[model samples]
Target: MSLDQPAPPAGQDDSTGREFTSALEDDDVLRAEHVSKRFGAVTALVDVNLHLRKGEILGLIGDNGAGKSTLLKILCGFQRPDAGRLIVNGEEVQLRSVDHARALGVDAVYQDLALINQLSVYHNMFLKREKVHWPLLANRGMRRAARNYLDEMGVNIPSVDAQVASLSGGQRQAIAIARTVYSEAKILLLDEPLAAMGVKEAAIIMELVRDLKRRREVSMIIIAHNYGQVLEVCDRVNLLQHGEITLDKQSKDTSVQELNDIVVEEYRRALEQRQRAAS
Candidate 1:
C-alpha cells in the first residue's frame, strides 16, 4: 500500500486496485511521519504516520495495548519517538517537554484529567499558571476568569469555588478540558475523554466536544473506544493496529459494524498466532 493511502479494511480486498489519496493538505495543524518507539524489548509504535487538519476532529481507535496512549504521549511531547519527525503548523520541530508542546499551542488532556481533588475548580483550572499579586495569589481574578471561560465553553459547573473532589466524574473531565482550552491550546489531544461515565455524563462531554468543533477555533485528535461517539463527533477516523495506522476513512464512509469487525479479526489473528506458538 502506498503511504498516501491507508490499507483496506481487514478481510476486505482493494477491489478498486487504485491507491486512495491522502486527506492531508497544507492546512494540517499536526503531522507525524514514520514515527517509531521502542522500550527495552517491546515495540510500542512502528513507522506510524498520522495527521490532524486544522479545525477538524480526528478519531483514533484501537484495541488495548495497540499503543494508542503511547502515540498520544509522543504527540503531546510527554514522550519522544525514537525515530521519525513531528511537524506542527507545517514546521518540523522537536518538543523538549510537555511545556514546550504547550508553548507551541499543543496540549493533551489524558484520562487521569490531572486535576487536584483538594483544589477548588478555579485553582485546578489555573493549576501551575496561577496569577499572583506579587505577595498573594489572585484568587478572585482566577475565580471570575474560570467561571467566564466555563460558561463560554458551555460547561455547567456549580461554582468556580467548589472543590474538584465534590464534582462528578463528567464534571471533572469537563474542567480538565476547559482548563486546557483556556490556556490557549490550539491543538488538543484528548485521551479517552469519555472513558468511564454514565450515559448522561458522557452526553454532557460529547456535547462539549461538539461545541468545540462548532467553534472551529482548535484542532483535535480524540482517542476513543466508543465507536458510536467517535463517529458522531469526528470528521475522520483512523484505526491503529499492530503499532501502525492501517485504516483511515471519513466517519461518514464507515460504520460501527465495520470497525467492530476489523477489531474482532485482529483478536482472532492474535489468538491463532499464540496457538501456533504453543504447538
Candidate 2:
C-alpha cells in the first residue's frame, strides 16, 4: 500500500488491502521473509521480514545490541540467515557471498568504509576494480573518471590526486558512497553513514542522500541512530527491537518524540525483566 493511503481497519480482513500489499511486494526491489540468524547461543535475528521498495530510502533504527547490524549483514550477503528466503527483484535466490550480492546489484557501505588511507582518492574510488591498459595501470583514465563521477554526484573533494587520509571524514564517506553508486549498485545498504560525523559533514551526506532519492534510481536501506535525520531523508522507517521489526511506518506519519518514547519503553521493560530475574 502507498504510505500516503490510510491503513485498513483493524481486525478487518480487507481483501482489497491484501491485494494492494501483494502488488506492492511485486514492486519491492528487495525483501527478507522469515529470516532468522544465530551465533552459537546468541540469537541475532528472529523471523525478520523487511522490504525495500524501488527508488525508496528506508530508515532502520534500533537501540544498541538490537540486531540491526546482523540484519544488514544478512541482507548484503556478508552473513547468511539460518532460515528464511531473500527475494531480489521478485526472484528468490541464495546469496553465496558479498561478491555474489554485488553481482546481483546489491552493495553495502559500512561505517569503516574499507577505503585505504594511503591511496589517492581516485585510486581508492576504483580500488580492486581498477581499469588497465594492456600491462600498464590506466592512471589517467581512472583519475578522469573518478573526478567526473564525483562532480556528477555533487560530492566535493579537494582533488582526486589527494591521499584519502588527507580528506575530512565527510569527504571520505562521500567517496565511499560515490564509489558504490558508480559500481551500479541498485540496492544500497548504508550502515551508520552519519555516525560520528560533525554537523557540516553529516549535512553533506544527507544532501547526497536526498539527491539520490530525487533521482529515483536506487533503493536504499539506511541504519541510523538519529531519528530526526532519518525522518528527514527517508521515505519510510522501521523500528527493530529484540531481534524483530516491531514498527513500520511512513516517515510523515511518525515523529522523533514518538520513536524515542517507544525505545524508552523497551528499555523500561528490559529493566523490569532484569529486576524480576534478580528477585
Candidate 3:
C-alpha cells in the first residue's frame, strides 16, 4: 500500500468479500496491516495485510525465500514487523514475545510435535502444562482429560497410557493435533503437518482439519508446499513473493495453475520492480 493508493472505503472490512460462512461478518482472528519486516538491508515483508477467518483453513504458500516462514513467525511473535499493526480479533495488539501469542490463544504446531517420544500419550499431552497439585501430581485427572479430548476429536487410540513411540505415524500426528486442541488453541498454525505421513495417515490429518473447521472459534492456517494439500484443506490461499502478498484467492474459485502463475508472475514482477528502482 502506498500513499497514492486510496484507502479502503471507510467502515468496510476487507475480509467480508471472501464470505466464509464459518467466519462471522467481522471475525478476523489474525490481521497484519501494512506490515513490514526487515533484517539489516533485507526487507522480508512489506505492506502486507492478511486476514484469517474463524473456522476457515487458510493456506499460506510460497516458494523458497518467499517469506512464508517469516510471515508466520511474525504472527507467532517470534519476530516483529517493523512497520505495521498486529491486530488480533479486531484489536490492535502488540505481540511482544512468543508467550504473548500463546497467552492470547494463538498456537503453532510445527512439523515436529515437540513431543517427548519416551512418554505415554497422556504424559506427552500434559507434559509441561500439567494438572498439578501439592504433594502429588494429578495423573488420573490428566489421563481422563486426554481421553475425553481424543474422543471429542473423533480419534480412536488404544489408550492414553500407550507410549507415543508405539503409535502409528498417523496416530502420532493425531496426538500432536489433539494436544494442541486441548490447549485451548483457538487459532492453529500448522507447518507442513501433512507432508510426512502415509496415504491413510495423511487422509486422517486432512479429515481432522476439516472436522476442526466446524467450530466457530477454531481457525486454522496450514502451510504446505504441495498444491494438492492446499487444494484439499484450505478454504483460501495466500500466495506471497519476496515478502509481499502477490495473490489471495478463494480455494473454491482458484485453480492450481492460477496459484502457480501468480507465483511465477510475482517473481517476474519483483525482478522488474527492482530493476526499475535501481535504474
Give all TM-scores, in the order shown. Answer: 0.90, 0.91, 0.80
List where candidate 2 sits over 4 angstroms from the true fold: 1-20
Worst 10 contiguous positions by lDDT, candidate 2: 11-20
RMSD of each: 6.1, 4.2, 6.2
Worst 10 residues of 3 by lDDT: 16-25
lDDT for model 1 comes to 0.91
> Model 1, 1-279: lDDT tens per residue?
334567577555545432223332667899999999999899999999998998999999998888999999999999999999998987889989999999999999997999999999999999988999988899999999999999988888999999999999999999999999889899999999999999999999988888887784789999999999999999999999979999999999999999999999989998999999999
> Please, what is the whole-model Cα lDDT of each candidate in the order they appear?
0.91, 0.91, 0.82
| Candidate 3: tens digits of C-alpha lDDT, residues 1-279 | 224545456555556443333234366788887889889998889888888977788998988877777788888787888989887876778899877898888877766777788999999887767888776879999999999989988888999999898888788878888887788889988877887788878888888888887753589888888888898789899888778887788899898888877777877998999999999
lDDT-superior candidate, 1 or 3: 1
Which clashing pairs does model 2 show? none
Better of 1 and 2 by TM-score: 2
> Residue 238 deviation, candidate 3, in Å?
0.5
Q: Please tell me which predicted candidate would have the highest TM-score against the true structure.
A: 2
